[model samples]
Target chain A: MNWTIFHQQVFPIRHKLYRFALRITGSIHEAEDVVQEVLEKVWKTPADQSATIRNWEAWCMTLTRNRSLDKTRDRAQRRTAPIGQEAEYQTDGADPARQIEVQDLTGQVRRFMEDLPEKQRMVMHLRDIEELSYEEIAQVLDISLDQVKVNLHRARKAIRMQLQRVFAAEPVQTRNS
Target chain B: MKEQANIQALLDRYWEGETTLDEERQLKAFFSAGNIPEAYQAFAPYFQALQAEHAVQLPGNRQAVRMHRPLRWFRLAAAAVIAILLTAGVFWWTGGPAQQEQQALAPVMPPKIETPQPALTPSLEPAANPVAESQVPKKQTRKGTLRKTRSVAPEPAPEDTYEDPEAALAEIKAALALVSSKINRSKHTLEKGLQEVNHVDILHKKKKETDG
Candidate 1:
């Protein structure tokens, strides 16, 4: 394992790989394990294989996805999606009540995303949260670009529908108040 | 108002998965802004969740996965050490012991024959009769003088006659045997010559008695 390549190329993108793994395996610990496994694998790659790899980020994301899926399949148990820590969210200029309301809605949106189908959830996570290109998402997921677009569309539409219901309820609650 | 419409349009494209990464960023910015209109406020949480997801980091010590670089020179050094050891082993196996054995056997070599005696050369002079010098008592006196002379002179440094100690021993034995045979032959010649001299002396004394 060459530490130079791993530290320079793989270390900087560790969070990116972790996020992708978390989206797939749906557990923080499992996701961390998957990222660690991917980084070690990248570190141990022979010089010839490393030379052939053009994009370290994409390769690591792909490895994370595969390792996470493998770990998920091995356990064969229901996995929970990771919820962003409340502390991690920027609540910088908001009133306390507004912060609580935004945090509640954020949890609701996270659940909506969690309810999505596997392909749709992965595509949405990669595209919106991780901000990967359609092509890059396809490369990581080993799916067609068209499939990435289709899954992303369905995933967003589902979340939007769920949001609409919440928004519709908000107006009613406000009118009643 | 135009900016709001454009953001609304970008948001629509974002849901359709038609927005580029830059356009999505714009949408995320607009939704995250504090002054969003009441209608768009419902979607603010979603953009906030995405930002929060982006902000998520891998927890725990980063140093856990790091490894130290291996000591590469150790391999070369090990190989060189093995090579040197093998070469030394081969030398010892092939020839080292015999040379050692030779050195060890050197101190126990049989004493050298004092064959190059300078005094012995004068005994071979033709001007002297062999019968006159063949007396046993006179020969013992000459040997005593030679031994004294040998003790006074510094001995020459010895050189290795041959690598094989056994062969050098055999050659020295053969030379000693040859020297003894030559000495025996000379002793017989001197006895014969001395008998003829005694016969001549006897005949001369009888003729002198007759003449008297």
Candidate 2:
């Protein structure tokens, strides 16, 4: 679309797209690159063609997903550090102890997400973090509604189980102390 | 207690992937409000992480704004370059205007074809008969010869030729008209060739249809 409309409509969604790319690529810099590439692609498309797209946000998300996946593949060949190592969980204004706790929790959650299979991770991130509707998730991921539900279910179950294990260990550690 | 019960039920539905976004938001709100009971503390981090991730925005959309401005100019420059190259390529392919003019004039100034001169004494026999001396050469050259021969005749005096400017202008006009007609005749031949090609195409199509 024209610059005015893109700024108004499409540009506002860069955060969402960046988060999605970040979720996939794991590296903040790579995610930024992917988001920029996707935005450039959408910008390069003729206004008329982009105007015909029914859901520009979902379209941008889809582009982000594909580009991030490609970057992930390239990074895989290079065998870089696992995703989420660069994730900086903000703990604004908290006490130092609370901040460390929050950071540790954030790191654990990010690792849990990174450990998820691609589809499940994407479904969880889109639904929980990005707050997309099921239909929008399906549209962005190009999967069926049932597949989205199943994947989200599996992802949440995995995270829940991990949390439960950590919870179960807490009492033992307290008893030992 | 009732709120906890509601959250518990919502969490069940959420884990099952059946909660509406509103219900999910309700769950997030309850946990994020803090002072969670010991029973649900384990689940708080998951919701907290979601909030934390949501807070994670790209630092600057200003970068995107800046990027698009230069991108617009880049696209325009690319388009202009392509257009110029295409125009230049077509002109070069068709041989430019000067070459076209030379082609158009070629037929009017037919090249002089030299025949094998008969082995004879240099004679002034044909000089008295102006018609015999002025008769144009008749022996046609081979098809491939493109060389133009210089005239052996001495150049006419400029005064003799310019003496009647009106007559000279009329002669030039007549020569141009002859060249124009020859170009028209060549154009007609080209049209005929194109029609013949069309006829062949039509016949080929008909044969293909019949075979199909």
Candidate 3:
């Protein structure tokens, strides 16, 4: 397909993809990188001779999730693969708020999401943020529906636990953040 | 299947991921009341967020966005493979030995030229074989005589005509001397004057001498 069409189609979906990537990667910079990389691939590629993007957002989400997961896994491991595993966009340009609109609670939510188990984090993103069907989540995550439901419940439970702890630690006046 | 009073047990199971489809249906219905049950009150925000996500517009770019976006690289590789195959097909079409053979078998057309005069000039040239000319009526019967000479006696033309030079010269001198002796002295003086020489003059001279 012509790049103009691909670019125009991809541009409108950038925010959604960025938000999804951020939720998955837990870093605004990484989210932007994933989205830009996906767009670059779509822009420079031809559909006839190559793979066609069936659902651009889902496609971008999968790429973003994998890269983010890879980075997270790499960081968790002492033997880190350089910070550039599947890195695409620059963190320098554009504002950093693209990750989480600068609200402290939002930042906390993002951090807590990162702190959660990877499976749980991914489940929460697919179920809550993306509002995917259990089957769809299962398909994306390569898990059973039961696993999806379990992971989603655990993810929500973790979020609630973090929020409850934050509320208990801080004074009521400032706890909402 | 449980009525309103016992619904919280199913909701708890659902929070714990132990709820079945039947119980989840009850939750959707119970939440539809627009009023909160005290037991389910804390879960309200969570369900509400779910509703919002369900209705959320992601600005779907169907043309560009894909279900499995990252596998695009593999797809690209597949596309490259397809292109390479097509090129191979083209090579097979144009470069096959069969195609070369077809070219070899193609008809060769001679060049066209115009020469109208040559087409009309065949009758003007004599027959190539001199012997063959005798077949035509106007050709001299001498051809038959020559053929008879070749077949009956292998002799040269000079042998038949005047092979003995001395005998031919003697005969010619004797005839000329007789003519000279017969010539009148006064006529010789007149003959010395030149006359118009048509080919018929030779015949006329012979006839005049006979008459004289």
DockQ scores for all the models shown? 0.17, 0.22, 0.04
- Candidate 3 collision pairs: A49-B79, A55-B65, A55-B66, A55-B67, A56-B65, A56-B66, A59-B66, A59-B69
**Model 1 alpha-carbon miss at residue A170, Å:** 3.3
Q: For model 1, what is the alpha-carbon lDDT of residue A137?
A: 91
For each candidate, what is the lDDT?
Answer: 0.69, 0.71, 0.52
Q: What C-alpha lDDT does candidate 1 achieve relative to the native structure?
A: 0.69
Candidate 3: RMSD over Cα atoms?
38.1
**In angstroms, how far off is A18's CA in candidate 3?**
1.3
Q: Chain B, model 3, TM-score against the native?
A: 0.26
Grade the docking of candidate 3. Answer: incorrect
TM-score, chain B, predicted structure 2 = 0.32
Best model number under DockQ = 2
lDDT of 3 by residue, B1-212 (tens): 25645776766666676655556656655654555644454444444334333332322342244534434554565556556555555555344676555444332211111122223334533457455444432432343333332332112232244658998798679867855554443234323322222233455445533432
The 10 consecutive residues of candidate 1 chain A with the worst lDDT sum are: A168-177
Listed for each candidate, the true contacts retained, as a fraction, are: 0.43, 0.42, 0.07
Q: Clash pairs of candidate 2?
A: none
For model 1, the superposed segments whose C-alpha errors exceed 4 Å read A77-105, A171-177, B69-212
Tell me how many clashing residue pairs each candidate has: 0, 0, 8
TM-scores for all predictions: 0.57, 0.59, 0.40
Considering summed lDDT, which 10 consecutive residues are worst modelled in model 2 chain B?
B149-158
Q: Candidate 3, residues A1-177: lDDT per residue as tens digits?
A: 443345455666666566566556655455556776776765555555334555655555565667667655665685542343222222222445531222333334456776888788787766655556787677667789889988978977776666566645552222111
Cα lDDT of model 1 by residue, A79-175, tens digit: 4444554444443334677556655655677679878998898899999988889889999899999999899999999999988887767741111
